[model samples]
Target: MLSMLKRIIIGAPLKSTELGEQKLNKKKALAILSSDALSSVAYGPEQILLVLVTISAVAFWYSMPIAVGVLFLLTALILSYRQIIYAYPHGGGAYVVSKENLGENAGLVAGGSLLVDYILTVAVSVSAGTDAITSAFPGLHDHNVIIACLLVVFITILNLRGITESASILAYPVYLFVLALFILIGVGIYKIITGDVSSDLHAPIGTPVAGISLFLLLRAFASGSSALTGVEAISNAIPNFKEPGPRNAVRTLMAMGLLLAILFSGIVFLAYYFGIAPKHEETVVSQIAAETFGRNFMYYFIQGTTAMILVLAANTGYSAFPLLAFNLAKDKYIARMFTMRGDRLGYSNGIITLGVTSILLIIIFKGQTEQLIPLYAVGVFIPFTLSQTGMLVKWLREKPKGWAVKLAINLTGALISFLVMMMFFITKFSQVWAVLIFLPLIVLGFHQIKKHYVAVGDQLRLTTCEPIKPIEGNVIIVPVAGMTHVVENSLNYAKSLSADQIIAVYVSFERVDEKIFEDKWNKWQPDIRLVTLQSYYRSIIQPLTKFIDTVEKKASESNYRVTVLIPQFIPKKSWHNILHNQSSILIRTFLLYKRNVIVTTVPYHLKK
Candidate 1:
């Protein structure tokens, strides 16, 4: 029944040869990979306004300057990542770039930063989408956390189904959201030129908070940098694109960046022109929509599409995290399980891990977008800086074509990303301290995992080992709980092994009459000796394991093997098996690695 349900959710398994068919074309790739960057325009402009609004009256006036700073950084990043896409067409983004040019530790730092960033991207995007929903229908305000978590689960299922399927399902909403925003921007521009819209924009002219200083503008730019969080995803997942993947990926990255620039600039401009301040109940985008289209069909359409694209934005994280994890796993920096693909040819373990981790973040923060935003851009900018620096280093060493031009671009980008990351740390230190603490811990964990895999490989390598040889003989021990067909079946198999001796042992919790069991044993006339053990504390595994150790010690000295043959009863129903004590399973687990000891199971199916 569980297998059928899994098949229904994830679809029937795809053959390994069918993996090549799963690559995405540019159109689908744009939606699946760029949604996070595109949808950030929904709140990115608003984040800038949110910071500037603390000044009371002049907030709208300063928004454009701060937004322009973010745009400059965005331009540098897009150009830098294009180089990343072209140079390392196979993908891995900052982790690969830094690891190759910088060193192994630098690569792990980039990988760990990206891992944290992807998780926060999902959490923050879904929370923002839920905020859009509640803006349209206030009834859902209390259940935002639940709604966000459910959306994460749904996106996780779609991704687990495969890349092609998720792209097909998510592309429509992304395109629709883009179209709606373009319409909003075009109409707003026409209205502004024709004298149809004007505002003597005024915010609460009251006490001035912290004066309008350069520091404040930097803070706003840092907050707005969240819009650029997912731009590196395309470079990270070039392998997911169709053949000529690097070319297609670069094109998609350009398209996504252009869209983000236009949409973000237009939204900030219209919000300032219309005096659309950030409201607790309504978003800046929703407010701009209501002002432009009047609470009508187009307004609700904008709100609906905004919510959808914001929710689907998590698809970007879903698309890249698994691929990055696969790379780390291949390098032995993470678990080997992450290297294995699921039936649908997706990295199922990484997908599930990202989903569960993001859901936990949503729950912990109560689906508050404001709280999660501080934790978002720090992780992304770390990679942005490191990736650009790594590229700059490569240019200096290799001096390829246009190396000087590429070096100039990356140097500026690295400096800007470093400044922004530092601003986030300085301005939002209280909220982001935990992220600062987690980054190094995650890197340490990756190193520990690498060490374990290395030790395991060293122990398992056979280059210096000798050939196998047969043992002198075998002494088999059969463990019996009662006189039943299960016990008889095990004894028959043990006798067929031609062992030097076959000893059947039974362990009892306390003093119990054994006359009836002895009589039954005599009646059966089995040509084997039975030894009974007493346990004062009712610990069955300890007594049984102690006896096995004693037997194994004596057998090992004479070049003999000690085999424990356990009889197990199999019930028809899986749940019914739980009713019986799992002694055989416990015994097998206890002696799994004992020297010169072998454990085997003999199953007797129940008829009832």
Candidate 2:
């Protein structure tokens, strides 16, 4: 059933030829994988505001500390995953790390988390982009879900076509967004420092609700940390890089990490400096842009760039999801379809599946960025904790040179990630507990599926009790339709069996024509007795069963073994089965039920 779903969702499994043609270079691959982290700069600030809105107005100032903490954690994670890329350059991501160091179950859990995270990434990024665009053009607010889904479909098609193509197209817009944002922040800061900045456009005192607490603080930090969601995507695509893959991948990751930190931190600072208050309906980026440039051309540019980045941010999931899914498929934790590449040598099926799932989420959530933010952090942090823990175990087990340093780094990362996850659970339980529950159920389902495969394999074992031998006094019963290639093949097969007696049997819905029999006999070169059976209802199984029973009775009386050769046409196309034909399967099944009888199929392959 899962395999069927994989096909329906992802298309056909990819072949080696397809993969060979679609191999991605290091620079292009890095850009594709890093898109998610880079795009987070646009909406990461807004997510901070989402949590702070329920607290006191002072909670808006908390963006600074949350950004700082996230940057600090982001730096540590980058450094840690640099080692991951170096250690396993073959693109395992969290699953590879946990499987190698922790255990298979840990790997499965990591995979489940990563899968959920990738889906959330798409929905969140697109929804956030839609919010930015709507903020810029209020007329678009009502159609946000429609627009978000359209973008998802567009990205899916691009990804399905080829990774390199998608990367090349996305890189220019991403770079533009980065430049535009940095320019906006730099100009905004200059205005503030020069005493040229105007009155804040955001609400004044009593903007946010009162009664802020530590819970709201933690929620704000968790929401801001959503910017760090796609940090691990590059680790999964390391193998797609050029020679010295891990080295180049590590370099790319560091570059992405530093750039993300600067951009996200700069945006948050600008938003705070401009007195941008947390509002359930507004995005901080757009709010900052309107305040800084006052709806001018530059402000529009910033808003446009923010929207572009948010949309492109989903490209990060496009690259990472397929790679993670491929690894899961390789480990048999996911359906084998994910392991298959497309003609473009990409995980096309997985890409489309992720796109479709994300689109559904966008529609269901009505493209509300605030609502999706809670579900976003949980999946990402689950893998973050497991991967960090796996690294800690690796440092302990291998005891490599500078093992103490590595262990400390891993331990710190694991501890911090776990605390964040726990806090997210406590603070956002009503909003995100559903994801936590669903992820484990998915993990358990994979385990059950694996067990079923193992049990079936055990049962299918060929035991020593069954031995091969030639039957004495072999009688061949050839069940055929009108003289065709299938019947000819059956006669040849019966000859090869060296049967003591051979009879060609035919089932008819009505009386057999003598002239038809005479004509068939004339064409036959190998001599064999002909027998006919009549079925009033034209049912093949019932008549064939009766004939087989009579043959078994005679065989028992003569102490001879009977071998039935049923002629069948091998279907070359999926639609070929619609044609009316005798059911050879029924005849073979009935023959197998009788003792001292062996059923052999003589098949004629049909042209497609």
Separate clash counts for every candidate: 0, 3
lDDT of 1: 0.90
Q: Report the Cα lDDT for residue 189, model 2.
A: 88
Could you tell me the lDDT of residue 94 within candidate 2?
Answer: 87
Q: How high is the lDDT of residue 312 in model 2?
A: 81
Question: TM-score of every model?
Answer: 0.95, 0.77
Number of the predicted model whose TM-score against the real structure is largest:
1
Compose the digit string of candidate 2's lDDT tens values, residues 4-106: 8645554554566555445556556656777788787766788787677666445677777788888888988888898888778898888889988889888
Q: Which stretches of candidate 1 lie over 4 Å from their true place?
A: 202-210, 465-470, 593-596
Q: Lowest lDDT 10-mer window, candidate 2?
A: 200-209
Judged by lDDT, which candidate is best?
A: 1
